[model samples]
Structure formats: structure tokens, C-alpha cells
Target: MRDGELLAFAEEERFVREKTAVNRYPAHAVKFCLEYGGIDITEVTSIAFGWNAQKYAFVSGGSQMEQFYDSLSKIYSKDVKTLASEKEILLRFQPERIESTLFQALSEVGIRVSKKSPTIQYFSHHHCHAASAFFCSGFASSSILTIDGSGEETCLALWEGRGSQIQITERVELPNSLGWLYSCFTEYLGFRPYRDEGKVMALAAYGRPDTNLERVFDKVTGLVESFPFYRVDPNYIFYGRHSYGRRFTDKLVTELGAPREPCFEVDQVSADIAYQLQKRLEDAVLSFLRHTLAKRPKNNLCLAGGVALNCKLNRVLATEQKEGLFEGFFIQPLSSDAGTALGAALLENYRIGLGRHVPLKHLYWGPNFSNDEISGVLRKSGVKYNRVSSVATEAAQLLSEGSVVAWFQGRAEAGPRALGNRSILANPTSSRHAEAVNLKLKRREPWRPFGSSMLLDAADDILIRSEAAPFMIQSFLVKDSFRKQIPAVVHIDGSTRPQTVTRENELLHEILEKFRDLTGMPLVLNTSFNGLNEPLVNTPDEAIETYLGSDLDALIIGEFVIKRNGTSPSDLDS
Candidate 1:
């Protein structure tokens, strides 16, 4: 992120072949970034970590240990030895130990410098989240909100950014996290916390809140002045040594009924709970923003952290501008912990007087395989393919015929959303396309809705109050008339997550235009080109392997096109 331009960025999961590979040192990711930038470890100026571990340990260690000890007393009633052991575990979060572990891990991965060791700097976790949004937003000034499932004991932080500076106005800590609250509900509704939160969000669309269910949640999260935005009763949540374990309490279960078992069918009760929880979260965020803007008003808003990934919640925040609080909205696309890396870099760059912020134009910052490289892989694999004159035209022609095309071009996308480069594309005009891809190809739940990749010109025609949504991170209501035309991408709530493409995305934009020219529709159903429970395909080999194994209609890699069912690439011309 030198000079506000991203030199290289990638998630470790893409290279490790693990989904959401959390708590793992991103050695491969670091290696890729250094290699991509053509710099040795000695050439690096400084290393910035997204957490201020010393402050976290000093401010939160005692309180967290106390919370853990109390939770054990309530749950077990007589586990003195166990509680002591857990307290010891919590005490191990010392900054010196953390720093030593980091350096040791990096050295093991060949990340050692030949010269003087680079100066390592640590920034507050929430501030890093704020920086990621406010800096990349290209706004001169904005109100920033960062919320996540407890980053170094800080659950949420609010900031005001002006010029090259950002000031933290308020901060919330520990057992009162909106992210943890949402995750608790996500777990209770037969889903994995943090990982399956989007599933809960999707399921909410199918539910209507029951008054009793609403009351239950409201009671657990009563209004309080100590926490300005929201409140969570620690009694209803377990703040434990291992944050990844089950977080909901027995008290919550006693009130809300038993937790749903994993892989079990979602019942009406679960849906109703999801609905009430989603609404509660939205209400809290809206109230918090209203209070913030009314006191010290700002026209632009920037949001980051894991909760910002909720497109539905983002829509609520964006549309709230009608009430005259803010005029502009920008959400960091990689709004999770992954984004903190970028934020840390930007913060360091700013400190060194190199923070001439360049607004993010695109997220194609990872590895790219050339045509010759792709050709070599295909030849080695002995797969039949043709080097088409224009791969976009060929891919579009295949899509117009209702075929699902694995479109792999340019660099892999930086975040979870597939912005065309590594995508499984289908015609969005028919509902069958989505169903077929979900059930037969990707092998995921059938109810998960696909996103649409449309030309920038089509946004106004397709969505209400359309804005430039190139990142596919914001949801917009589908214009009633256009909903039926792209049913594959439209959610049950009549909203669609769209990546609006312009000339900057030349190849994907060209593909969309060609599809529109043939079918009278400007969008295509675009989903990540990965199999069930797999990270997105990062290389031509992974793309080819997935394409060969799945029920895809065609594979488009660089200039080469591979079709199934004995179909020839020449047929695409006809």
C-alpha cells in the first residue's frame, strides 16, 4: 500500500486451500506479496501489525480473566482448578510473547532480513479497521464506524476523519460486542458462528418476526447509557478463553429454547429468531449513527469490520441519508480482519509522509497468469481447448445460450466476492440457472442467492436509488419491473447484490456488454469459481481442476476456452 496504491494483496486461504484459515500466520500470503512487489525482506521499510497487544494486555487482561472466571463459576458452579488453568491461559497473551512468536514464525517461513531488522509497529485493531475504510474511501472527511467480534478486547470504535488525521471519539470493549451478539444468534440457529453469519442473514429474508421472539432479544440486549450504540447482557453470552467456541449461554437457551444442532433443518422458530436478531442489529446501528451525526455532523460515512459485510445492513445505512444525516457512503470491501493488513500499511505510510491517498480503482492486486502460462498448464493436463480471438465474446456467447461459464481472467479478486476474474457465470434471466449451479455445481445450499455483475449503465434501470456498487458489497432493491428479468440474482427480499462494472474492468465490462447485446440483459449471475467449502480458485490449475470436476458448460482462461459435452469452441462463433 505504498503511496496509497496497493502493490499486492491476497487472503491466505486462497493459497492454503483452507476456508477462512483464521489464526494462522500468512506466510504464503507474505511470500506472494514480497515476490509480487519484487522486493527482498531487507528492502522492506517497516512492518506494521494491526493490534496494539501491549495496551490490550494491560487494559483487558485482568477484566477478561475475571469474566472468564465468573462465567465458569456460573456454568460449572465448582471448577476452581479448571478456572485457574483458564486464567493462566488468558495471562499468556503478553505482548513480548506475541512478538517473539511472530518473528519466529516468519523466520521459519524464510521471511528473515539479511541486514538490520525492520522496525515493527503495532496499531490499535479498531483504528486499523477505521483507517482501511476512511483512507480508501477518497473522502476528505467522514464519520467512520468499526465493529467486529472483539479485536484485542475492543468490540467497536467510532472515529472522525479529517484531512490526514483520524480521531477516535468512542470505544466499546469486551462482552458487549454486536458482532458476538449476531454470532450467538447465528450459532443458535444451526450455523457456525462468524463463518456462517451470512447464512443467517440470508435466512432472515424468509422470516417474519414473532412478537415473543422480539421480546426475548430485547430483554437480552436492553438499552443502556454506558454503551451508547447497543448493549448485551454478559449473562446471556460466555466470554471464554477460546473465542471460537460456543458463545451463547444457558440462560439464553432457557429463554429461546434449545440450540439447533448443526446440519439440522432450519425450522420456523430458527427463522423467526434470525429475523428478530437482524432487525435488532439494524436498529442499533441506525440509532448509533443518528446519535453520532446529530451531535457532530459529517456528510460522508465510512464503515468497516466484519459486520459491514452485511449488505442488507449497509442498504439501511445508505438509505438513511434521506433523513439528512449523510450524503455519501463508502464501505471497505475487505472489511474483516483481512482488511486490517491494508489499514496498517496505510497508517504506516501516513506516518512516513507517503500517504497521498489514491482512491481504490479496482481490487485486481493478486497474482496473474499470462496466456502462455495458462496454455502450458492446459497442454500439460492434456485437456482440449481452443485459443479464441476474443475470449470475452466466446464466453458471452456461451452464457447467452444458457451455459454456465467458468470465467477466469486477469488477477484473482482480493476479497470473498468474485468480481468477474475468477467467477462461475450464468445467464441471470432465468431462475433455473441459479438452481442448477447451486445444486449441481457448487454443491452449496440451494437457498443462497447469487450476485449479479452488470454494466454501470444498467444500475439505474435495474435498481432503485442506484449507486456505483462495483465491489458487490452493498445490496439494492431490484426495480419491480426488472426483478423477474434477473430472478437468478434477486434475493427473496427483492434485493440484489450487484458488482456494477465500468470501463475500468475492461474484460468483465466487455463480457457484460456482449451478453446484453445478445440477450437484452446487462447482467450475468456471477459466483466465486470454487467448489463446496473451498477457497476461490487462485491459479489456472485450480480453475481447470474445478471446471473438469463440476457440471460447468465452459471454461474460459485467458485466450483459451474449454467446452464440455463434445462441444467445440468454433461452435461459439455460430
Candidate 2:
């Protein structure tokens, strides 16, 4: 963003169709951003790399072996032999090889530059996370917190943001990470760690937190006040290890019993463990925040990193504002590693003195298709399609008529949540609608609840409070009177994650308005536009393919509409 104006921003996974595109340079994303901004690569003033590869170089060079071994000793309480083996494995991280691979990727995309070509800068991973949150938070001065899986050497950091500058007040270096702890439980519950932590959070709502289990978690991974900041007990939580392999040691397994197998039924035992893990995480985070708030006395707090994606924890922080902890809070929409690209750019902008702190209004920063593009794809596929004058009203009508509609409009969204632009829409008024979507469309777990895209004006009427949740990042309690009215969106705990729609995306706002006019309800069931285990549709071709393969009744892309069977798009024009 230059002077508070967004040129372009997008995630690499959108174009590549990968889930998380980790370690992959975003060549396609960068090309699209430059084209969208009407600028060439040569026109760019500087490039800021998000991760400090040099830190890895030092680690791999064995310069920090003693420090690393000392931290591990404090956590593992292991003998010299065991620490030596761990150090040997750590030395295998070839930073030079990683750098070569990144440069080769850039070269393949024609982004070669000499050392004197431009002002290339490197940023630590957590610094970018902090800048991503605090800079876009629109707070003149605030306390910042970033917690995620290991980033270079640090896994957590606390900062003070004033104006366009931020100072790192404290940091919890790796070998101890709250994110790793949560991910350990995520793996134990038979879900993919890092990617499926949100699922764990959702499942936690169903189980009761066992005090004995909670005590066990505290003993293994509790936060300890370490003067400037808190640190996770490293003895139980393993960091600097690959996420694919075993996450917990024998000690954790002895305490928690056997780990759940993937695709197995989630019994009461697994659910209770998930609940206890989530509770301990929440308690530890709240303690750290309370300590920070007491010392800083800042009414505004900003959070980022992978851990910030935990909506349950975010709900506590946002709702507890009434308790005087904070008056304003903002979490980055893309709070994972995918957002580090934007964070790097934002940090460089701040350093160049061109930064203007402005609250981000939307996430529609990816590529969009024109009517001609949509029509071309439809015609090539030999599908019946027509250009409708009122796409919003037509889609709203289909949704109101108990038909699932695949909505593809404007540019794609950046993060995991699909905010109306690329979404599957249905009526939220019936439990059957959600069940059908889960069984026929998504083909996923029945226990998972769908989200909603709600009209901003009716948020207070339907939800417990009217919060600006444009990103669908936080869940709120559904009002008792409206829970039955929007059963598909209401979870077992009566909470719904909703994306509050305003005039920001005019088409989506109009659709919500028409839906409300038709059914007297202000929300539509919204979920990512993809089948089970698939990434969100990016191009019009992908959208059409998904629509044809799924049980969707109709698809609305741009101004063009396509329906299954013999129903022409013009049939809904009336």
C-alpha cells in the first residue's frame, strides 16, 4: 500500500491451486499484482523478503549450536548424547540450498536482479507479522502480539507500535511455541497439524474440558512469566522438528494415552482432550495479554501470526473489551504465512516513510474476470449460459428458492475464508440446507457448521452484537430469537461466523438486500467454493468445472449465469 492506497495483494495459492504453497515463491501472484497495478517490475523501488534467510544460515553453520542446545536442555532435560543428535539434525537445514531454490524460482519467472539493481531488504518473519497487524490496525499507538510456528529463531514476539514505527519489546525464541503446542494436540486428534487447528477449535465446542487433562497440559506446556514476556514449557512441546512426523514425545503420550487415528470416529475421549488443549491455550494467551495490557495501558491491541486465526480465542479478546482490557482490537485477515508477502511490502513502505495506517476494508485483491472472459469459458465448455442484467437479484431468488448457488463475482479473496466473491450460497433458514450442502456439495463432516454472509444493518438483530466482521474471522453468539431462523449457520453452541456485508462489495450487498426482501432474513449461508479437500476456485474455468461436478443447481459468474439441466440462464432473468 502506498500512502494508504492498495495497489494489489494476493496469495500464491490462489493462482497455483495449492492449499498453502509453502516455500514456493509467488511468481504468478507477483505478475498479477504488477499487471493489476499497471506497473512493470523495473518500476518497483525495492523488494523486501519476509524471512531472514541469513538467520537460517547462521543456525545451519552451527554458530548457534550451544544456544540451541542450551534451550533444548532447559526444555527436554536430556543428556549430552541426545542433545548432540538433535544438534546434528538441526545442522542439516541447508540455508544456502533454500536461497538457491528461491532465486531459481524467481529466475524462471524472469525476475532476476543484481545486487546493485534495487534496494533489497530482508525482514524477520515475526517482524513482518507484527507490521501486518499493527500497521493496518489504524491505531495511532497500540500493543502488538504475534504467535505462530517457528519463524527463524523466534516463535512469539511482543511489540509497541507508535505512528509508523514499531519496537520489539520482547520475544520468545524457538524451542518453545504456543502454536506448536496447539498443533501437537491437533495432530493427536487425528487431524493435520497447522492446517486443521481450526477444526480442533470447532470440535472443542462440543466437549467439556477435563480439569485433570487441563492440569496435564499445564504441566507439559504452560506459559511461565519470563520477565519481559511469557514462554511455553519446551519440555512437552517439540519445535524445530518437521510437522509431518510425530509431534509429541513419549511423556505426552504416556499422559494422554494413544493418539487418535485419521478418519476414525471422534469419541468422547478425543473430544475432551481437544477441549482441554483449547482451554489451556486460551488461558495462557489471556494471561499474556492481561500482563501486556496492565503494563502498557493501551486500549488498542493488534494480533497476527498463524495463532491469530483461532477465532475462538479472538472472540474472547474482542468481547472482553467491555472488561477494560482493550477498547479496540484488530486481527489480520490473512494471519498465516500467506500474509507474509503483504507484511513485507507494508514494512518496506513504513521504512521508506510512505506508510499511512489505514484499516483494511476488504480482501478482494486477487484477479477478476470480465464478462467476455466468463462467456468465453462457458462457450468453450458448450454449456448454456446467458448474460443477465440483474445477477444479484437472480442469485438471491435462486438462494431463496432452496437451491444452492455457486457465486463467483469480482476478484477472489486472499485468505482461507471466502467472503462472497467466490462462495457457495444457500438459504441459512433450515437445517436441511446445511445437511444437504455437507452431504451433496462439500462431502465433509456433518458436524461442521456453515458460515453466513449477513447484511450489516441486520447484524445486531440477528447476532448478539454488531461487530465489523468483514473477514469472517471471529464467531459471535446468535441471538436466541434468530437461532432457529438461521439454523444452518448456527453452530451447536449457537455461535455463527459471519461476514458482515456493506457497500464495499456492491454486488454482494445487493444480493443480501434482495434475499432479506424475499425471506425477511438478512443472511445467506456462505462457504468456500470448492468440493471436499479442494482449494477454492480461482479462474472461471475452475468455477465452471466445480459447478458441473458438484450438485449445485446453478452458477452465477460475473454477469453470466449457468444452470444445470435445460434451465437457461435467461429463465431466471425475469
CA lDDT, every prediction?
0.82, 0.79
lDDT per residue, candidate 1, 70-90, as tens digits? 654664433334456456645
lDDT of 2 by residue, 363-460 (tens): 88888999888888888999887677798988988889898899999988889999999999999999999987876679876667789999898898
- lDDT score at residue 235, model 1, on the 0-100 scale: 60
Name the Cα RMSD for model 2: 3.1
Name the top lDDT candidate: 1
Q: Model 1: C-alpha RMSD to truth?
A: 3.4
